[model samples]
Target: MRRLASFFLALYLASCSGPYMGKDLFGADEFVLDSYKIREGKLSILEMEGYSVAELGDEDLEEYQDRIHEDDVLRIFLYHPKRHDIVQAVSEIGNSIGYQVVGGEISLPDISSVKVEGLTLGEAKKKIEDHYARHIQDMEVFVTYKDRIVRKVELAGLVSVPSVPVDGKIRLFDVLSKARVPTDANLFKSYVARDGALLPVDLNRLLKEGDMSQNIVMRGGDKIYIAEPSAASLMVMGEVARERVISLPSGFMSLRHALAEAGGIPFTGDRSYIQVIRGNICKPKIYTLSWEHVIHLPNDSLLLMPGDIVFVAAKPITEWNRFISQLLPAFGGIEFIGKQCGSWGIFVP
Candidate 1:
């Protein structure tokens, strides 16, 4: 009867046990938690693979020529070197006032109209000088650009302002300053898109290293995308006092500092087997470090990087207790089974 009772009890426990507990008992290597292993050196979330910084070339310079378009206002000043009367006559009629370019032509009062649209500032000045050459001898034409169509550059991601209006020539930093980019902006990954092609910019080099080459001249219709800082965070799990996700600040964080943030490992945790898991989900690089040895060596201190996971492995006794805790839910049916067996006089005890 005692052997029969032991056999039934063993069968009942086996039927109640879950596949997860069984795998744990069999020592199946499974990652129950996902985390990052922060490391030393520069960590970049932006894809810098197969990417190189583009140098400014002649083609880039040619794209910046500011040409006069329709609706552009020009302040024209005309002077006749030999004839003072002609200069006085033109100035008295308010000929020096703003003249709107319409249909590619700038009309002179009681004079011939000259086409100036699609021409650069220097080209337009020469065109006006040639027009007055036929009428006035030794004529000087001074063209001053007044109000024109507002040139805009689209700013997206992490900028306080979206659309920025530019006058004359503007640089990449000038637009960012005007937009008031936040401190957390991912400046290294920011880029400028022109003519459907993206040009990666290193704002950190321009700001910190004083690399003037990164300050690219901005043009009208250019789109600047300032990416927000990567959601760089680390998870501290296992035998820590508090298992939580800790957000990584800009710059480096040491393993000791990260452990302190997680409230340190509990007394029951094994300090000799601190595990740091890294890499992709399917194939992860597992590293085991002894806290005792690491604490003694200054150079051996692990610096946490973005998306790192620090796990303080628990002691074997604590793991056994955890295993037992998981099986507690299965024992809820024990009382019902005992009562049925008692009614049938099966002697459940």
Candidate 2:
């Protein structure tokens, strides 16, 4: 029974993917460096600079990120020329000299209120000391972040009404797990919008590759919007064992994973011209990786994300189907356009 079932499954897969089965791609060894296709209406890799995923040695967090916000607890130390009794009493007494920022200001013992909101620790300490200088001859003020109030980021898109709370020293990576973001969410486009501008955060690197450089500090009241890609799953087409759509994995799906999911590179699979099409439909980036390169490189050398389309090219895609025959060298990206058009205009590669 098991043999019969296996035979039937094999036959079914063969018939289902008969047209795509073919010999190895020509010039596999000849192709050296993986490069982009300029004529495929695909966007150049240079245009992806705004995304900032490829930067090196970037700072984890900036000094300005430590700026004061409302509802924060501040530990203030006071010094006086000859008032050791008053200083000791204040530190040993009421609220332990820890003051909370209320209405953008903290009410000290003598000073009515000192505005410290939107200021750094140094700026706040200077402001507080200046405010007290008017009343006291040589009073000093020191301020530090005793405790940051717990704040929640408004997580919008691709989740079940989700929001990630930050108690203290939280990161975008930590809260992303709390949000339970799906693999189908477009990590490349995900960002934290704060103060009406997007922060330089690359969710793809942080979530998929575990790149700490991209793990930005999370702030309260940040709007983290995770966008859905044009396609829910990656389209794996062209000369392979079985052309299909592969759902993205939680971490990342490499080219090997995609190939294995589609019953792997077949006996007749083309070993040349494996293209990984990324970016949007109208302006995609086609990364041409030969099978020789994939075989020799590390498994994670070519990790895939949602909205990626992997195409194992054989010969030119001339006579793919009746409609796409005229399209001329159209590979897996056709399906993306077909989906965007909401019509079965061209057959997917």
Candidate 3:
């Protein structure tokens, strides 16, 4: 029952959606759109996409209402063509009361205080509505901060394209298309980083699985770094000095270099052979490379890619049995043995 409960809990945690999962787990800095903080007063709750809001108190709400237009970047979007007069009136009201249009335009109101800058047609309507909601009596306002533009972006692991810029309006597809991402950019294993933390993101799931909800919208000043193909390499479970993720430097690195980076081999490691397992398919390609050959022979250096698992297996059972036999006599005595094993046994066992 305990195991079953744990299984369900694990499944539930694993199945959580991107946003519900803690933000700390996402690596939006690298092709991730999760790290952006919308400057306050710029856009209303309805306008910003892909963000869940925190609770707002009445005092905060009142302050938001009192804020001047310049305090935030307004995005107004207009729908009806016949509402030019409303837009005109809204512009006049905004200008009369120290409200400036950073972007977008309305029918020329004779107000000299406010200037219309870079607003889209939809953004224009939103600005007009916002003006009415705050200052004008019996006026209506409607604004939204939906992703209005899309641009290209790209990601390369350590050896390839490592920098992915997220500026203006960008889509996930645009980012991947920007640079020649290596084949090792695993869709499932990829992550995003932001604010000095790592967050998990599904690159393969987003691209191949077509999960529209995870198709994040990019904002300005966002960054994404594709981890080095060697950085995400798998550990050799059966043997190897250190069973951990090994990050390789950029450039033409080889398989032998990876083994060296992982502290070479343990004293118990089999010096005769090392193996690499590729892919999860039925017929996993298994390659044998000699430690001496890999170190000295230039032709034996095979370039390691991301997610490759290298194993430097332990010596054969026959050798382990011999070693055990050599220690059997030492284990039989109960008195002198205890003295000899005192600190050594405590540390080892």
Candidate 4:
């Protein structure tokens, strides 16, 4: 009975101990790092300067394809000896709602819905003349074709790198290289939108894709967006060298590179048992593994992706309370001596 009672006593003491507190000399739990706490309430992603890109919707791009003059072309007049007001009036009349201006002096009979994205005055007139021959009773207007610079286009997406304001006559490769399109760009399945329709082009079939040169003409307001590599991505959090989304590449990018991109763990990091939260579905599914194995093991080079949250928990605190408890008997003995000394001192007084 006594043995059983003693066993119960031990169990009770164990239950009474705090989760973090231990009788040992040290604890294994770690203190929290400020960085581990995410910004709460509202998250504002600040755009990086010269690194921001905008995407256009299909509806906005559809306005440029309606029927112009029977012959569609563009034209421009330089030093026509006309006042600026006259020039402006003519340009407005050509572009008005009821009339479509194809090119120099070529106006469609009915320009109900005609818009052009990239065309100078000379070119515009040619388009009008080519497409709306029946609409114009008299095509006698003569305007000079001055290929003047007009509107500009915007391109963004996964690239070898990222840049902004990449103006001038840009090719597909130039923009791709400028954007630093990720290696994971699906060359076999690429898409561009025109008039509310997404046109998929195969990068391998350049001619079929309408790619005349390795370089494709960049229209003003044209944006080239690269896509994420795959739907399956992993979150690399907790004491990692890198903390951003890692698009799985065709070739291998080791764990070291991922860590390097994450800025590596701070000096205060607990090197062992780096934590990775997988899926993060209903609850954060935690995985603990040593750094050595992750770095050395071939299977540990897990591909990372966007929206993966990586966290490195601090080192566990040592169980100093356990050691303190062991010294309790010694403290008890000291108390008795202290009491006796008090009595002796009193008697001498």
- Superposition error at 164 for model 4 (Å): 7.9
Compared with the true structure, model 1 gives a TM-score of 0.60
What is the clash count for each candidate, in the order shown? 9, 3, 35, 82
Question: Which runs of model 4 end up more than 4 angstroms from their true locations?
Answer: 1-144, 147-149, 154-169, 172-217, 222-272, 278-282, 304-349
The Cα local distance difference test for each model comes to 0.65, 0.64, 0.45, 0.42
- How displaced is residue 300 in candidate 4, in Å? 7.7
Best by TM-score: 1
Error of 4 at 278 (Å): 4.5
Candidate 1 per-residue lDDT, tens place, 74-174, comes to 87767765777656665554344577899999886435998999898889889878877786657886776777887789999888888887554677778
For model 2, the stretches where C-alpha displacement exceeds 4 angstroms are 1-32, 35-114, 120-126, 136-151, 158-168, 177-189, 226-233, 238-242, 249-256, 264-349
Q: Which stretches of candidate 3 lie over 4 Å from their true place?
A: 1-94, 97-231, 237-253, 266-268, 281-283, 297-301, 314-349
Model 2 has a clash total of: 3
If both were scored by lDDT, which would come out higher, candidate 2 or candidate 3? 2
For residues 1-349, could you state the per-residue lDDT of candidate 2 as single tens digits?
5875586456444433222233433232222222222111111222332233233234435322457889888887788879787677656533464778899988777567888898988998788878877877788776777788656789888766567776447877778888888876776556678789766565766776677776766767888987776423677887778899876433246677788888766545556667776667766656666677777866545566556788876543322342344333443464568686667565533
**Local error of candidate 1 at 220, Å?**
3.5
Q: lDDT by residue for model 4 over 123-202, one digit each (tens)?
A: 55555444434543334333432233343444445554434432345545555555655555644334444345443332
lDDT of 4 at 169: 51
- How well does each candidate superpose onto the true structure, as a TM-score? 0.60, 0.49, 0.33, 0.34
Q: lDDT per residue, candidate 3, 1-349, as tens digits? A: 5875586457544543211122322121221121121111112211233234343223311211112222343333333355567566654554454232344333323223233344443555455555554544444444433223322233435324544555444555566656555666543335444344433344554555565444455433345665544444455443556666665322123666667667777766776657665444354445555576566655223554444567675665534555556555645664465667784764322
**Location of the lowest summed lDDT over 10 successive residues in candidate 2:** 36-45
